[model samples]
Target: MNSTYANGTVHRYEEIKFVPPSNNHKTEVQSKDVTILPNKNVSARLYLSKISRKNKKFPLFFYIHGGGFCIESTFSSGYDSYLHKLTAQANVLVVSINYRLAPVHPIPAYYDDSWDVMNWDARGKEPWLKQHANFSRVFLAGDSAGANIANNIMVRASEESHFVLSLVGMALLDPYFGNGKPDVLWTYLCPKTNGIDDPRFNLAAHPKILSKLKCSKIFVFTAGKDNLRDRTWTYYETMKKIGWKGELGIKETEGEGHVFHM
Candidate 1:
């Protein structure tokens, strides 16, 4: 790989540890890994309350994790613990996606992997999803860079009619977006892009796409101490200003760092 793209290559894999699927009795949440794309070695960690009967269906929470789009996984320990509690308490089935990282696969690879996973599950190929998930109440969520991916996916879903899943809501936690300025990280991931002015990084630039989000509701969360906090507020304000026909909400955790809720 080029030296410029070799940023955080070693530290990322060393500091973050992967957590295997677990069947924790305390939370009553059981998780297992299922392959979504065998050819790419891509997979997702499925989390659901084991106590919840198969006859009953729960909202599907499609999640993506964050590590600057270069690190982290659906199996990361932090995400695993957080999702376990979320699945148990919220009574929602979680599909945490593990997308290919950058510097090797680069920009569109991770985005494409996430979209492919959604399409794969919508076909009813997984028994857990088919039997226990309520497809009509699906929600897409992510934190930091994953939030960026979630936003892009939502925009694409709105444009395409064949995405079988019903995405009723989306939640973004400290989403990584730019304020109409050049962003070094985004450019590093997508080398050929038009800097941060690209709609993928700056959603506020494209009012039409923001107005067309397929989901009817959106929740944005930011940490007061996070450097990206202001950008999130800008996104919320832009969404409201566009007269997008969606119920929107935002919250900021006082004195917290990025993604502190997780």
Candidate 2:
């Protein structure tokens, strides 16, 4: 893949692609985009509706999109479509971010962007978040690499005083953690990490991190045939073993692959 190149040689591939924001006004969900990182031009799409503004007490859904820290974005067609529907059906405002990719931005870049955006929301710096979103019921959700980002974010949120988050729940769909040998792409993207052992890549590798999740519950979904199934299931079991106080939920489909719900 072009993203694997670390040499100075430029690879112009992986151009940013996006599907336009939803335009159907029949549904209550209204969408808008705003920059979270001005220097990098990184942005997040916010889905808020008139109903969400009724009392400014609607649940907040903060979403992270999966691309193995290499590709894809919040605005990608598949992701955008999903968010649009989710916002309406769930009757919540969703903030889906576009973080920096790897082999170009490197490890921690993705995490940093999410962290910054979360803090911005925590401080009520974002107009839409402070105006219409309910912080007390904020839920984090993601698929694959996005789930990894959400998990990492939750861990950091628990220990950091800077981020005043009211995280109520986390939904990780087919998270990208590994059980054994790390995927070559994982190493390629996060070259600074210690392959699969890094807590960021495999949470099971560090059970102590489980206690740091600052949420009431975590929902993990894994498909039977997904290569990462064992690792995710193990994480759920290990969390229970550790007496993680939060309610844990796990779901699996017999013949599905990673993130079949998407």
- Candidate 1 similarity to native, TM-score: 0.94
Model 2 TM-score, 2 decimals: 0.92
Q: Candidate 2 lDDT, tens digit per residue, 118-139?
A: 8777777677777777888889
Any runs in candidate 2 off by more than 4 Å, and if so which?
1-7, 10-17, 50-54
Q: For each candidate, what TM-score against the reference?
A: 0.94, 0.92
lDDT of 1 by residue, 138-191 (tens): 999999999999999999998998888899999999999989876778887887
- CA lDDT of each prediction against the hidden true structure: 0.89, 0.83
User: Model 1: how far is 213 from its true place, Å?
Assistant: 0.6
